[model samples]
Target: MRVSFLLFAGLLLAAVVSGCGGGSAASSEAASSGNTASGFTSSAAIAVTDPVTVGTLKGMSDALVVGDHIVVRSRSDAFVTLNGQPVYPGTRLSVLDKQGKLVSTTDYGFTLAAGYTGDWVMMLSPDGFIMVQSTSGTRLQHFDAQARLVGGVTDLYPTVAATSTTEYAAAENGGAVDGNGFWLATTFSLLPVTDKTQYVLKLCKFDFSGRQLTPPFMISTSALHPRVAAAGGAVLAGWLEGGGGMLAMWSKGAGAPTIRSINTGGSQPYPLVLTTDGKMGVLWNGKATMTSTGGVMGVMIDNYGTPLLATGRTDLTQETLSAHWDGNVRATVIDAHAYKGGIAIAGSAVGALKAGEPITDVLVLADYTLGTDPLSSSAQTILRFTLPGRAALGPTPVLRQMLFDDHAVLLIGDDNRLQAVYTTRNR
Candidate 1:
């Protein structure tokens, strides 16, 4: 794991040095809006609010909501306390609507934060720990959303595996439900110390009513950094499993997961993403021997983790990458040489049936490829019209949070600002 982290850091440094400089604020804002002839549309106006400037250094950890508001977690150095005593560095969470107006703000008063945006409810916790706060701390603490903190310390750290340390909270239904709409899915690790290292992957479901729908259920493999996507009543989770050697998916209402190992010849699973409609994709360096052999691979999956379509290597070497899905179609953006040179690929599901055989979906890759003439790409020129305010993008950008709602596609970049691309025609 340590080696993997070091390798990732080195790759990131190399990308930054070779890629173009960070994009300017103006260029990041000038991207186009509305549907294109190619079937791509502008972000839904409902999800976009006027941009709010929180601080000079906008950490990637800040939270933003597309539809009603955008929340910027103010940088710690610029902390201003309501009463007295310094608020923890990452303790401030701001709120704003689509019009960029300030809706509300809260002082978490602690450090180490985690959060997920839903339709109406935003779940937040500090240091992988969600608990009730006492009134002895400060007056500002009393004003925040106060939900009854349940369970004991043992219930919190149910597992002791090293890989189980970092837990991410995701909304099962875009956090948009009132009665039975959405629930919070908390994915974490339970590591048991022994002669051999092992981990237990667990997912705890909590309804909007703040009650535990079910206790944490363990998945068989050691999957890390799992992501969940929900559509209708179905929930899909994709994660790096089996010591980061395999990509796995499990559906809440769809039964057991069907795991697939990427034949990368000893390369880590890398990052995996699934579209709102349940399409699955993964990106990784092809082999440990070569630097230029890195590429992205994608597959379309049914509710039962069955692959409906598959896309072979889309070669990318020493480049920063990101991907998102527009329904069953997958779209990827690659910035090589520091955001100077870039390529965009859009893939659709194509399939045919064989005599006496069931139909299998095939992924047909189409080049919407955009880059500088020949070579020497310019960051400003590549994504200027797509992601405004995002500059010197990284490979992780390809897997940044892309939320698909009924009306539009929400492109949340590493910068924490969001771009909404609508799908339906305006009435």
Candidate 2:
């Protein structure tokens, strides 16, 4: 566990952007006649956590909806709340389900720091919230849609012999839930190999009831950061190795992952959008040649990690702020949520390149087709909304992908409140 919460604590986007699923019939009616912001409703920001109080934060990823309004968020310490009040006995794993109707918990076995960022993580499951908690060991707890304790918590560290002591940004992991179950892409430290810092990159799978079902798809690589998303029965991942980018994959029942090094040719491409399927995309930074500027580069791969469209440039404008490549600014806050046939990106852009220069604080929204060029000026819709007054944009904004009735919805958090605004082309 990396104890750098002071650095990473502020990077949370607050909400995951999955197209929201079926909800309670009453709240569904309330949402129909609800207040509209950029086309979605704006809910009042409630007092969810005591930020000033120092305690361990349970879940650091976005608060994903379990059934209806059952938002499963992480607390720094072992605790759960209802209506801003501690409702569970002692400090335990907590949940809220049934369109904000209930809050319950099952006993959690991890004793962790109160101020740690995201040792405990949550994702929506068929029954309810599935929490992956890391302490000296790993525990998986299951809850029902009504926020009731489904089964007992399963400690996987002993079952799988996989350590959970690795730096993992649950958001960047691209861990997804499909029809079969959920998949998480993360790294665990192995014994020092030849006195070198070596890691075991793994994609682990669990059944709907929080049981480790099969052997994980793993590879021994030097890449420190890897992102993963499940596409039906398979998983796709992208990571950096030896100053280059590579994409690897694993079938559900496969023994090991099939890895491939992406050949960028003469183009200097920066890693970017990786879809639920294995189709990888990159934004050319125009660093290699002055004439090429910026364009979209991608390679569409098949189910077995074979290339359908080998890496090539697509017809899109190359204006994703090349400063991210030149090291003018290091910290960036951004999130993208895939829904229906398209994806919605919303966040604050990087600060000005030169200090003391006038900066424009605005919220940016980009909508695009799955394989289409979103940076293209004419092909996709890009909107930049200047914030009220000369407010600043520092940490990434909290944006969630959801659906309000039939509209493709994007919920952006402004002034600490998440507004269900920013509709996309497809529903």
* Cα RMSD, model 2: 12.5
Q: Residues 1-427, candidate 1: write the lDDT tens digits.
A: 0001100001011111111212222211111223222323233211222123323323223343434334544423444454685433444555544333345655543332222111122333331113211111100111122222233321222223335535332212112121242333233322333345443455445543245565655653454444444444454444455444454455545455555554434443322223333333334333211122123332334545543321342322322221211112122332111110122222221112112322232122111222221111111111111223222233222212222232212223333432222221121
Off by over 4 Å in 1: 1-52, 55-57, 77-89, 99-104, 111-196, 243-255, 262-297, 310-427
Q: Candidate 1 at 283: error in angstroms?
A: 6.3
Best by lDDT: 2
Candidate 2 at 143: error in angstroms?
A: 2.9
Task: Give the C-alpha miss distance for residue 421 in model 1, angstroms.
Answer: 13
